[model samples]
Target: MKTISQVSIFIENTKGRLANVCGLLGDNNINIKALTIAETPEFGILRVVLNDTEKAKKVLKENGFIAKIAPVVAVEVSDTPGGLAKALKVLADNDINLEYMYGFVEKASEKALMVLKFDNVEKAIDILQKNNVSIVDDKVALGL
Candidate 1:
């Protein structure tokens, strides 16, 4: 899989807070590829993989949202039995520790596109590549 930038925006857990973030992106024509929301009593984190990260972040900051970028891996896993287990085995063998991960499928051909966050990204990528795993490019991951 390829390494990509994941943008996490801090959003207040209120009625229209999420709506505001979505509206901002919608108005700017930015497409969100993969998203995961983690929440607490006070706030929520909107983790997104965007088609245009730079512009999205800039606009979010201008609107007073706290946005940060981090590296994450994207892998196109098979849509069959043991697909995910097989991939995870590769990382386990290589001693790669996964911090967190998320994914989605764009079509019937594939079941999942894995987005992973780990400390040793370079090593993890090298291992996956050598094992012939399909790694998606960060820019391409945005699916613009």
Candidate 2:
């Protein structure tokens, strides 16, 4: 799959705080392509992949949120069992460490997409291809 910028915003673990951040995006016309929220006892990291990452970053910064952007790979795979395992095995075989990941498929598409954050992207890509693992490209992802 293609590599996209993932913006992680650290927010206070309070009720409505997440809603507020999401509302801001809506108000600014930013569309979230995919999102995941990982929480710790102290705070929550809102990981978002959006249509306009730069604009989203600017908006978050202007609103006083601690945000960081990093590259992540999105891969589309079969929706059935072992799809995730197959992907994971490829990376494991090469000793690539996956920091985190999450994704889903459109109800219409049958194939699921996985957004993976790894330690080394280039190596990960190489390993994936060497193992015949298909990485979804930007064009394919955008349906271009």
Candidate 3:
């Protein structure tokens, strides 16, 4: 697992908004490691972990998108029933507040990727290490 810069974009809750934002990143060659869209009636929060975070943010901003960058931990956990529960318990024991989270598993794999937005990142990292939580780097995640 590793600490990555996550870009959160506030977009209007419309069909084409997501496509436009994604297209901008794609055009700039910023690979999205993980992404999720949490929508309400008025707006949507698009959380993205990108390979080129700065570039993505710049492009988004130039295109009139409201974006913010923050540090998040990308963890690779087992894709089992209690996998997320185990991780959440570790954070809870340390009193780390999880602001937001998103993830997905590789097709046909037992491993899953999780992006955790927490209150105290360093503390959370220490807690995870103390609890023997394995973190997958970019290379490890992509099997590169």
Question: What TM-score does each of the candidates earn?
Answer: 0.90, 0.90, 0.85
Better of 2 and 3 by lDDT: 2
Output the worst ten-in-a-row residue range by lDDT, candidate 2. Answer: 104-113
Tell me the tens digit of each residue's lDDT in model 1 across 27-105: 9998778888899988999898888889998999998999999988888789788998888999999899988888753
Q: After superposition, how far is residue 19 of candidate 3 from its true place, in Å?
A: 1.0
Q: Note the Cα lDDT for every prediction shown.
A: 0.84, 0.82, 0.80
What clash count goes with each model?
A: 1, 3, 2
TM-score of 1: 0.90
Checking candidate 3 for backbone clashes, the offending pairs are: 1-135, 1-136
State the lDDT of candidate 2 residue by residue for 24-142, as single tens digits: 99999887767899999879999987767788999999999989999888787788999889989888877999999988334215678778899899888888878887677654553
**Per-residue lDDT over 94-117 for candidate 3, one digit per residue giving the tens place of the 0 to 100 score:** 788988888843522467778788
Model 1 C-alpha RMSD to native: 2.0
Give the better candidate number (1 or 3) by lDDT: 1
Count of clashes in candidate 3: 2
lDDT of 3 at 119: 86
